[model samples]
Target: MSPPKLVFYVTVVVFAGVVIFTRDLLYLVRTETRYGQLDQYDHAVRNKHHMDQANLKILRAKAGLVHDENNIELNLTLRFQVNGGENEVRQKLKYVDKTVKTSKKEAASQGEITFETPSLLTLFTTWSGKGDVNARTHNFTLRNWARLKPEVNPVLFIDDGYDATVAQRLGWKTHRIPKSSINGLPVLKDMFKVIKDTYKSTFYGYANSDILFTSNLVETLVHVYYDSFYSDNTTLVTGMRTNIVNLTEEEFSTQTTLLNAVSTRGQLYMTSAEDYFIYAAEYSWSDMPEFVVGLIAYDNWLVLNSRYREDHVIDASRTVTAAHHTVREPDYQSHFRENAQYNKVLFRKMMQFHVEPPYEKGFTNCIDKYTEFVDKKIEIRSRKLEDPCLF
Candidate 1:
């Protein structure tokens, strides 16, 4: 080859190498800086300066205030006259963004950041009884959950006497679960079948109407599915929830905004495992009781039944944020009425006698942390079925 031609080729190769090296260096620097900022924020939380009452107000407002059981509410006001005023408030809120971003990055690294689930998820909710805030809040919640995995197909099963139009407007595959005065609510097991028969997705989730899910749910679900790490087809994943009273329509526009608000204003309280249930579509749970969902102990019954069947019940609190929106009073009160109370007694009886199922062997439980489940059939301990710890 000619010397001039050889020189030209060498120069081109050197330029390409330089560009690649520069790009990689910049990426490394950005990653390190982000991690460092995250560490700094965590350290700042522990600093003595953070404990000052003046600074405490700002932190409480940004992180959310929870009243003690004694009804003493934590005063969280951003209107305090700090030295920097609005600019300081802005920085406080900005820290929330950093905290959330840091959390996302850590979670992504843990799960290896796969954006899609191997198979489409078909998630559904059952709703009955209503107030004005019901549809608006639920629509917002459903859409937010859907965006977590755009591949998911959502279904809404409205019981008799409930409006289906609102759900249809939100793009859910709407259907009516038949109600009967004789048996009361529709059969829970049959409803599950209906959802599976209607939508042909690989996985199915049944959540209560008021429950709201964050993006972490589907991400964790997908991660569990991608590697077949949770359990076999019979596995059920559930989690603890955070409760927020009086959520408005304005906060529903963006997931980040709602989540940050939840982090700041919401009270973290976990109810029974019945609030959420996710499992493979092919799961065949037999002889679910005629006890309707709204009945006091029905949700608990579902958990016990899963245990009886020896199915894997995973507590996914580490990755899921189940947000409950409590906006009305009477609506929440009717849940503890006469019929529901009776059902609770019945549930306790069943548990005491071990009358139902007669399956002596208990199911394996994976609670709190996420781990890849191998095929070894390892013995997992049984946690207290009703115990809900703060996330």
Candidate 2:
């Protein structure tokens, strides 16, 4: 009934519909394959930053202090370095009143910084080479932090495995907190109280122990942590978006469907209880790191509870947190062997290594792994240092 031109137009429209329909059907098949949604997420996380690399000793909780009958102002260091090479290279250090700074670029790499205040909040690594770095902003809370001296430590926390002579010989102070925590929460609470009482503030960073600094991670964190640029009203900081890390709106809807089945939050720990739930690591069993979703939920809660923007970031780089809970050769041989070989990597790369318990007395301990990883990285960089583009 239509003219020739009209008929041609209709044919064009119908063909377009078929093509779009076919394309969508293909996409549906691809997304539902065994790899499914997670494959896409892996690529997103891996690209955040090249492998790389905070001292703000401030906490402002209403908690009291040890000095005052005192809550707990403390020096917190996560012993993370496993020195397995030649002899121990103890470098010279310079100490200022409230500030413990190294004389040279690498001086702080293998030294300790002590805050005499009963309350100090810091995220320092166990290994000297791990690097103590924080922005000058955090140091604003220090009292005369720039008094110069050699090897100054008021007191240090000693674990069951610390080299006792090092702190003693250094003329530093040391007090040990015997127990560790789930997600470092217990130790941190004490540390938080210690700092808060001294500083009369409650600024805290529940950060990773492996976070070493070649550059100032503290500076970057302060910039990002307080900057209002990336966020808007009613939004939360999820940091970098990782693959499969953030569920789609639909996946979230289904997660809700499954979440309701749990009677208690702790019951959600078992994957069998619900695949949607992931429980705490041994140390985190009680308080837990809060699930990715829960972290976001907490952000919302924090936003609601206070007018302040307590931005929490889940994404940093491998250098910031290469692996959580050490992954061993056996693990690599099994879980990640074919990761790169796949057309689409199946699992999202893990960020931090959870320290496995029942400590082993060997060079291959978890601390050793981090040092080895760092050394290898340094070696690789040294080789490429000549390239003008690298600088």
| TM-scores of the candidates in the order shown | 0.58, 0.27
- lDDT per residue for candidate 1 within 1-391, as digits (tens), equals 9999999999999999898778667755664664465446544543423366776555533322321222121121111122333212211111011111223234333422322222246777676644434666666666765554334567776665677665566667777774432235554666777877776655787777778765445444544554333454677776555667787776666656566556565554423334777887667756665555655556656666766566666666444567778775224453655465545555546653332321111211224233221221111223443211211
Residue 133 in model 1: lDDT: 40
Tens-place lDDT digits, model 2, residues 210-299: 111111122122222223322222222111111122212332232122122111110101000001110011111122222221011222
Report the number of clashing residue pairs per model. 2, 50
Question: What stretches of model 2 exceed 4 Å from their correct place?
Answer: 1-36, 43-121, 125-157, 164-174, 178-187, 198-203, 222-391
